[model samples]
Target: MHAKLTTGAMLLAMSTLLLPAAAAPDWQMVAKTFGKSGTETPDGVYRIGLPRTDLKVSLDGVALKPGFALGGWIAFEPMGNQAMVMGDIVLTQDEVNPVMKKLEESGIEITALHNHLLRAEPMTLYMHVFGQGDPVTLATALHAGLALSKTPMENAAKPQASAQQIELDTAAVDQAIGHKGKANGGVYQFSIPRAETITDSGMQVPASMGSAIAINFQRTGAGKAAITGDFVLIASEVNPDEQPRLFFMHFWANDDAVKLGRGLKAALDKMDLKNS
Candidate 1:
């Protein structure tokens, strides 16, 4: 009976040891290191939005709002004892190289650097950064890189008082889109996940990594608004004709998914003929 009791206690201790460790993200340290507050998603990702309010951008003679073009963001997701960070930083032509150098020096990888818009008054570029390490260290590196640019560290810019009210029926828009949205700096923003799962490098990609379809609306007038943002789609879902052309499709002044789907299909068909 003593041997049996010893065996049972040993089994219980082993089972406890084999159990999964609790996920604990040091959010306070992350915020302190980044010098900005962040919002935690339901899935436990802490996301910080750093909009370039100092930039006054114009496209085709229309003044572009920060929500429309100058939004930079970083997200941290807990990965076991460490954390994984992914971010897109907006920079001017001159600021790009300096910021890139800072991030590289800090051991962050530059995944992609490209233009999000075709032609604007002052050209803008986006740098995509990825890093995995101690969460506070990652945030510190990110903060240092951002300091190289004119990007605001915190709520440095005062909110503009608008005489015009928001014209779009936001509640209806949310219902139609199947997701709730938040208003930020005069833009109604929605971050919606794909119905299907998304994976990268054989691992599941979370919505916090800018993998969700981001839609933004800036009110122009009564019942009128300018819409802009991108839709995240995988290769198979984006193009059925040509060799899987996976990319985010950015749209301006349009929010119809069916029309965009048709446009993508047509473009793919044309590419297929060219390849053939």
Candidate 2:
């Protein structure tokens, strides 16, 4: 009995020593247009920038506007024993492709490259990025990508897009989702409830996070059915609800799935998916 007890104690001590500590990734250098007015949260890293109106928007002074939007992202998991970085870029529409191509060449991955608004002059593109290894290394990669962008590191010089009521056929969206939805930018938005039995990371997912399905539509054809945007979902075995609001915005129906999967997976692991 004494021998067995001694062996068990030794095993317990060995197990305790093998446990890993909570990770704290070091962000070494960030070379962004605004020089880092962005905020880094437990959830992710976010940068805010105001593009030059003269180039991105066609407008004059008195109408000048300071673009103040947040680009939130973070690193979640470790890879092959290294830290993985993941995040998104929420900037004016035109900045998307440039950022995507640059990041790709620099060994960064872009999962979903799309928009969040409608009729915003110059448009806006939301790019989701993912990577692995050192935090600073990933940040540096982003810096290089942003460096190639035409976006003005400063604020907007004029009011390019107005916040008017966008027209949308709410009835149609509701019909598709089998529920009622509200109007957001002249377009109808619908939310579908996920099956209650589903949960992510052993946590109960709220109706707002991953539970409430969001559907945005645009009128592409004559006056009939409009082409709906990609239906964002938790594709990986990791339920998106595990990180609540920390899921990559994939360009699902738009191709580029294989190219996007690798980086997006890395980003998801790095992000602290808490809030829905």
Candidate 3:
């Protein structure tokens, strides 16, 4: 069975279940204009996966899976005559500036530029963008910017397109982590949502649109796993000065599955400390 892709994309196309009885935008047209298809999440947000399969990155000794850390994605939430888009653009060191320039030229706001992992063969940077406008226009501009890089425009390799075997004990991972996980192209992913509502520019943004705590696990060896994801943090919990309101973290371990689960639990506890 193919993994239900909510935390991933290259294939953000159609809504799996029928949308609500209320009238909705022509998502099929939007998906076509974007040059890729996608799926709609439970929260009514539409997501497109753009995993950077072009990059062969390894953390420590384990090769990183595209869904683990290289998952590039764009999400759309409809708003009457317009829509809001948010996404992460994966770029190598050289592709950063040109892509940023292109995105800016098209009026998309570059919300962030940072690294998710520590040290890898070739370093990677992430660009976060936000915009609200016509769905087709936004897709056109976003596609133009992605054209500058090697990010695949085709959906043949999207996480949801195929059913890759997952050997890890994902059931144990779900129990230890306190939430069920979804498998996408052999990667086990968890999108942990918070208790409070999150809004951007006066509109509510759901956890599916990059607001939730994301934890991804991919098997590297026998009882050994490689994990990486972003922890959405609030500034008030800490000093709240100089620190951005949110924090994204990456963790890697090649030792044992038990130890990996323990460490991940500890990290989640700490990150969710204030909320709990």
Candidate 4:
């Protein structure tokens, strides 16, 4: 009788351990873990911006603002019992390995690491991260990884009146790019998604998950601006012939860069499917 009672009690405890959490994750506690509040989109994605305001970076003789270029962010989307998290971490040359090591130790996947700019003073590297697990646990792990670097954990201050607005000729930029852009924290941003589906590791990838072209323009001075963004290319459009077209983009585009790029993409999409 005593043995049976002990066995039943053990089974109950094990079942309790295997069960999922009784309630949803404490988002406020997650924010407390990272020392930053976040906003939730209508689709239930909670995103926290971790701009590298501590870094003083400049490009093409124009100073870069956190909202303009150093805007690091981490987002969490609830996925059943767990959560899927994705983010871009902006780190200096020296802080990359240490922070990456910490993130790896915490079970975060470092998807890609590269630069988003050229000829910028005090170069910075971007570390793209993805993970799926308990929400609070994931946030804690991310906080630990960031703590390995000199990333600031203090509450961000309110933006100044001038810094809150963009000073660029936005209409001219739209006409030249052929894509309308929206203002985001003083930075004008545009996103051009691929017409076809994009897959990674045999799974369909969405545009929100770094599968689209993103362009950002930040006003450096009156009538002057600095631009930076990513070009998401399909597999067939990645040959040597297409390399120079993207790498050496600044030299061209005196006229309509977007139309030229769109035409090129369309051509490539219709390329000889037999050979390509």
- Per-candidate local distance difference test: 0.82, 0.51, 0.85, 0.80
Inter-residue clash pairs, candidate 1: none
Across 8-50, the per-residue lDDT of candidate 4 in tens digits comes to: 8889999989987666566788899867788775556677888
Residue-level lDDT tens digits of model 3 in 108-217: 99998888999976899999999998888998889889989999878764345456667888888889999998888789889998888999999999998999999998
| Number of the top-ranking candidate, with TM-score as the measure | 3
Per-model TM-score, in order, reads 0.74, 0.41, 0.75, 0.71
Arrange candidates by lDDT, descending: 3, 1, 4, 2
lDDT of 3: 0.85
- The full ranking of all candidates by TM-score, starting with the best, is 3, 1, 4, 2
Q: What is the lDDT of candidate 4?
A: 0.80
- Cα RMSD to native, each candidate? 10.0, 13.4, 16.8, 12.3
| lDDT at 31, model 2 | 31
Among all windows of 10 consecutive residues in model 2, the one with the lowest summed lDDT is: 60-69
